[model samples]
Target: MVDGALFAGPALRRLRRREGLSQSAMAARLAISPSYLNLIERNQRPVSARVIVQVADQFDFDPRLLREDETIGGVDGLARRLSDERFADLAIDRDELNEFLAAAPHAAAAFARLYDNAAPAALRDDPIIAVRREIERWRNHFADLDTAAEALADELRLSRGDTGAALTERLRERHQIAVRILPNDVLPDTLRRLDLHARQLQLNEMLDPASRTFQVAIQIAALEFRSAIANLAAAPQFADPSARGLFERHLTAYVAAALVMPYGRFLRACEGTGYDLAVLGRRFGVGFEQLAHRLTTLQRVGQRGLPFFMARIDRAGQVSKRYAGASGAAWLDGDASCPLWLAHRAFERTGELCVHPVLVDGAGGAPAHWLTMARTVNGRGGARFVVALGVEAHMAADIAAARGISLRAEDATRIGQGCARCHVPNCVQRSLPPHGAVLQFPALEQGVTPFRFGG
Candidate 1:
């Protein structure tokens, strides 16, 4: 008997429609009242265990399909879209949103699509910023591409060892693309470049084994999973070609991560090893940042892992990448990241494990804190970057890194979401005052920070 909590009414309706059976006809076949079937199809009434059994026995249908919670992803996506600054005035609640999605998923998706077409492009002020946001959105999570990658991982029998060889073999046998490792001089700063006319893929020699394998996997995904990747790219409905190009590149990267780590296996390893990034990286033949980024994507339903927020920042304090896992926290919201974030400090002291406490919205309320561990990673052109992995303070007890770390409220370092939204009254690093807050520059009195914000 399918649980009422798991019943997907929209899915059942679609399945019924696919079988070309009207509500009355389906009800008659199932030996149930047409009104009851109609109510069940509309999600106004739950599907009983007898109804489930009848549907499966009579129609040879997979009952599990009707119980899947695929609408949750749509719900989350809708929530994120509505949280944008443009929709700040929205007064929607979570329960209502979920109900809407559960009952009318197609309508919800159409509404989201309309918002995508009409809502202002993310980071519209700067083209580069807009492109970055679009790319990051897909990088955070693309359900379809990730699913395809997972299926490919299962089909290809991908493992931690000899991934490059396997990918090369597939490229050669399936795509007829030759793989080559070019000298540093020949392929200056590039990681992997495909020569379609020559039927060759050129990768830089300086990259480590895992990196090479990842690049090769990316190449394979580009050629092999082109249609799947392109389909996801079109879903964003990107107006800029460059943004779409960036989406394609990141989609290949996503596929590459899946090829190297292969969702289920990597997620299991993460659980078995307490999510030790170093050990997991070694086991998967990947880098710290690679594993860190991949850790944020263990959002697969039923087979999920811990919720970890990962970010990459440069020495200049510019955030290049951000991903929030199932936590559903909008860690980055277009404001300059707080300078005190451990991701920035990791640059000053490389290779050191720093577990810092941060309050997302500062004091004077129910503070939301997170414990993050930051470490440095080498980037292209001898540049150094910082990668951080963290979870909520409440969930810190579950993480290995946060073990033995202080969880007292006072132990957390006071920090704000960002300069524009931060309410830190005396923050020395305050570059700008909080939006809508009155700025007071007392001519006689001075504080540690540049400007003082009035209450």
Candidate 2:
């Protein structure tokens, strides 16, 4: 193969199959010989830019599809799935995995799916995990929900008047549901509840204006977009009733967020403000966490915002909410975030933005640099949680928060996903040795960390 040439055999073959075209037919459409097309399909010859453009123009498809890394079920995703201790005996290397993926991408994806289905009952039946996995699978962007919300927003003229008042009036006029705010003593345990008998939606008086608006929007979602949300939740993967219920609730919240912040308007504000979280929050009348969460869902096809990853962690370092967006790093898959991450430190300086650039140790691939911004937000009942947003370091120039910050690797803090999966040696804050490492303890000498392990 020529040096630095593009090889996209799997993608080309998939496109051909999708188009239901024979190799000769596709070659004829592209004005190329069948023999040369065959070589390209087999990855023996590099796909030229001219051919790429011709394929795009002929098929009316995005040219970026051909440039995507067709690493089969995602290199990191498959690698993490194989890292399970059950596959320890196989001892698969990176090269072998790559070869297998390249040889049979569909089979590789099937194997990953099978592995997921074969998980232990405890992990498989966890409704929360299932819901989170489903969210990540869709990259937290639901076009149907976004479109519905945008239409509703336009009908309600949400951009012109007070959003909450407009939504409340809509409920009264359209659904005959009166919005009522009751004292905490009246509804001690519920934030929002719908009474079908009286056609009333009750909210706790303690909820702030933003929270009240969000709860109202959620009611709208439950009433208006029930079929859409139900259809999304009906996927076979959510066989568990609990999982389905959780997913439906998540979708409801997603729609509510979209209603509150219409996609086109919000995305324009995001770009205009250089993605300033505080400014966006104020403009949209949302809290810090809501602003961060909405930022991850701006993945409309042609007008995509920066691919940002968002997470919410409590004081105990437990991640309650996480969206990987386009930066689907394996670290975002689990709750074991590194102690050194700014999310943990945001607790010390509540309500203050903490910005840091860090090098995240990839599981078995090249390291990734990120520009992470974290701040504490007050949740319901006075509970405080840290919400962190991060984007790839290369995108720092476009972010307002990353201004005046150096993105050099040497100047960044080195952190890992967590101690159990991280192989960064001698980390002073490591709580456990990394997987597959040989632990060593010498009585005569003391290391920075409690456990010394061989790579």
Candidate 1 structure, TM-score to reference: 0.75
193-248 per-residue lDDT for model 2 (tens digits): 99989899999999889999999999999999999999999964566799999889
Candidate 1 residue pairs in backbone clash: none
Q: Each model's TM-score?
A: 0.75, 0.84
Best by TM-score: 2
Candidate 1, 1-455: lDDT as tens digits: 11214546787788789899988888898999998877787777777778889989999998866744443344445665654434433445556667877777778777766765674655453445454455444336666777778787777777644777878888898888898989999989787888999999988999888788888888878887899888877776666777777767777888889888888788888888877766897888888888887888876656767777777777766677777655545546444578877667777787876789777653233446788888998888788888878788787676678678787778888766667767767888888877657788888888898878765
Model 2 backbone overlap count: 0
- lDDT of every predicted structure (CA atoms): 0.73, 0.82
Residue pairs clashing in model 2 are none
Clashing residue pair totals per candidate (backbone < 3 A): 0, 0
